[model samples]
Target: MDCRRSRTNDPDQWIATCPEGSKAVCEELRDLIFRWEPDLKESVNSNMLCFSQKKRVCGISGFKNHAQLTFYRGSELPDPARLFNHGQENASIHSIDLPDGLEGLNLRALRSLLHAAVKVDTEPTQPKPPAAPREEWPMPEVLAAALKKNKAAAAFYEQLKPTYQREYKVWVGMAKQPDTIARRLEETVRALAAGKKWAQRKEG
Candidate 1:
């Protein structure tokens, strides 16, 4: 099914577009969410059925062979049941894959997860403290000498902001091998002469 065929606000219409293997599981998960948190506002965003209150609490996405239930602030929720099977490395988002059509599903554990998610959404969140400024990387001697020889590169490098200058410094300074440092230094000078930022440099 072409999930991106159209935007849908109706739950039934959205579920109808899910892959055949995952449709039933997705529907059941949707019902479970609504039953547990009747106050959550439902909407389809980016082809995913999302539930939100003060903020987006959770969402349901259907894939080829499985349905996924995602918690927006899942990193903050307790999952003693170990039901979450995906996105462990993510900072905030986490999800559970419901394969095999919900067979052997743990309803009690799932309910606990849902309840915790809703509670997190309802609670007021504290503003995050400002991040500490990153220490600048020292300029590599090879790059400094190269810049000194090329007037155009030196002029361009000098005009760049500290953030952009740090990019070239970190890239060249990170190379431990002498050959690697020489190669990166060559690339750095060429990029700077062409007025390209470190990220904008073309790979050979």
Candidate 2:
């Protein structure tokens, strides 16, 4: 199915369009989920079609060249092969990358695994261990005073890698609650200035 033009029966859900082979794989998995876990709910949250309970259990998406089945609580699941590459450690998100040529294989095993996974509790996730303490980025002094208290902003800043650190100074500095924003701006600043991600970073 071409998901770009498709919408789900529910106003909140939109079926996604991915590579042709990926579409088939997705449908197979979706059907199998219905067969195995009939009571599971489906909807779109954060603009992605998701299978969820409480938080989210899983999400399905199609992408260029390939597609992915995302487990929001991946780190909590058993992955003996360690195939997922989530760009950070101790995070729950992971993906099973689908390449071409493996299409049409009975996806029963995969579906069953996911159904079982939905039952596994994903909580008790450990905090991301700290990065080796490095010199705080040379933020402007005026910028520092402005930033000291906001938790979310500070969290954002810390997560950013060095390359994306500057956008924050510009964005937060302009806000009226420059300090609050600065404090809350950590994540954004780190993302913009350091070329890194807050979520990808293990949140302590």
Candidate 3:
């Protein structure tokens, strides 16, 4: 999925880009959301179709395996039909995942859920606290020790913009296999020592 925020605000463009089966499901849900509340404003955020009424109420996104309807403040809503199956432990959000080829969604129940979410957004609420400043990615011990051993590399890394630093961190952090992580860590150290961005390294 594209992690970069989309410049396009057109929800249809976002929905049309989904995989075959997911496209239909995404469009269906997107339509339902709008029909449920004509006043709800739609926008694309973080590569998903997000609906807001003064604040974000929900978002829908299509993935390879499923399309998810995520209620921004779903943790507080009642789920008598138990439609939500994910993010239950979260403090603010809850979600329902619709796998492709699944039977039709329970429209009656979904409408009720949407109504409840809308109500929450409409009600008076305490002002949220200001968000904290973004922190640097947590460096793995191996990476840290390597940088410490090379003062030039450490200085170069410290001078990188947060975005570049995040790219390197995500590249290493996403390695699922131990061998892959080890290899990436080694390559990362080499790149930093040479003052090269992660993307500038030759593909292995």
Candidate 4:
């Protein structure tokens, strides 16, 4: 399916686009999500069927071989049943892969997870602690010299936060070869001169 194309808010329309093998599984999972909590607002986001209360709770997507139920704040939810099989490394998102046929599907565990997810969404949120400062990387001599030559680049570089400055320094410093360093230095200076951050640098 063309994921970039926007899908209708209708659940049926979203289900219609799923692979034939996963159509039934998607329907069943959809029913389960609503059945567990009827008040959730359903919408299509990034081509997936997403459920939300005060915040996004979960989403469902049907792939070629399996349907997936993703909890948005899954890392914070309890999962004693080990139903989650994907996105283990993700900070907040995690999911359960429901294979075609639904042969060994654990409805009880799935329902429990859905209940917990809903409860989490309905509760008042606590204030998050302040994030620690990012350590700044040392300035590379090549970047310093290039910035010195270009007044515009130096002005922009001076105004940037340490994180943004570190991005340029790290990129230039990582270039081990002379040719690579020279190329990266040129690109960095050009981007900085154009008022672009390291991430916003255009590919040549």
Question: Which candidate leads the pack in lDDT?
Answer: 1
| Model 3 TM-score, all chains together | 0.57
Q: Give residue 15's lDDT in candidate 2 (0 to 100).
A: 40
Q: lDDT, candidate 1, residue 57? A: 92
TM accuracy, model 1: 0.62
Residue-level lDDT for 45 in candidate 1: 77
Clashes of each: 0, 20, 0, 0
Ranking by lDDT: 1, 4, 3, 2
Model 2 per-residue lDDT tens digits across residues 104-129? 53465566557656776344545655
64-172: candidate 4 lDDT, tens digit per residue: 7888889988887888889888988777789888774466877888888888988888776544546788777778888888898999999999999988888899999
Clashing pairs in 3: none
For candidate 1, which ten residues in a row score worst on lDDT? 1-10
TM-score-superior candidate, 2 or 3: 3
Worst 10 residues of 4 by lDDT: 1-10
Q: Which regions of candidate 4 deviate over 4 angstroms?
A: 1-3, 124-204
Of the candidates numbered 2 and 4, which has the greater TM-score value? 4
On residues 1-204, what C-alpha lDDT tens digit does candidate 3 reach at each position? 235667466887788777675778888888898899888999899888899998999998777767888998887778898889888876677889888434766778889999999999987653555678777777666777778888887898899998998888888878889899899988898888888888886644
Give residue 43's lDDT in candidate 4 (0 to 100).
86
What does the lDDT read for residue 46 in candidate 2? 51
Q: Give the Cα error of residue 138 in candidate 2, in Å.
A: 20
lDDT of each: 0.86, 0.57, 0.82, 0.84
The C-alpha RMSD in Å for every predicted model, in order, reads 6.0, 14.1, 11.0, 7.1
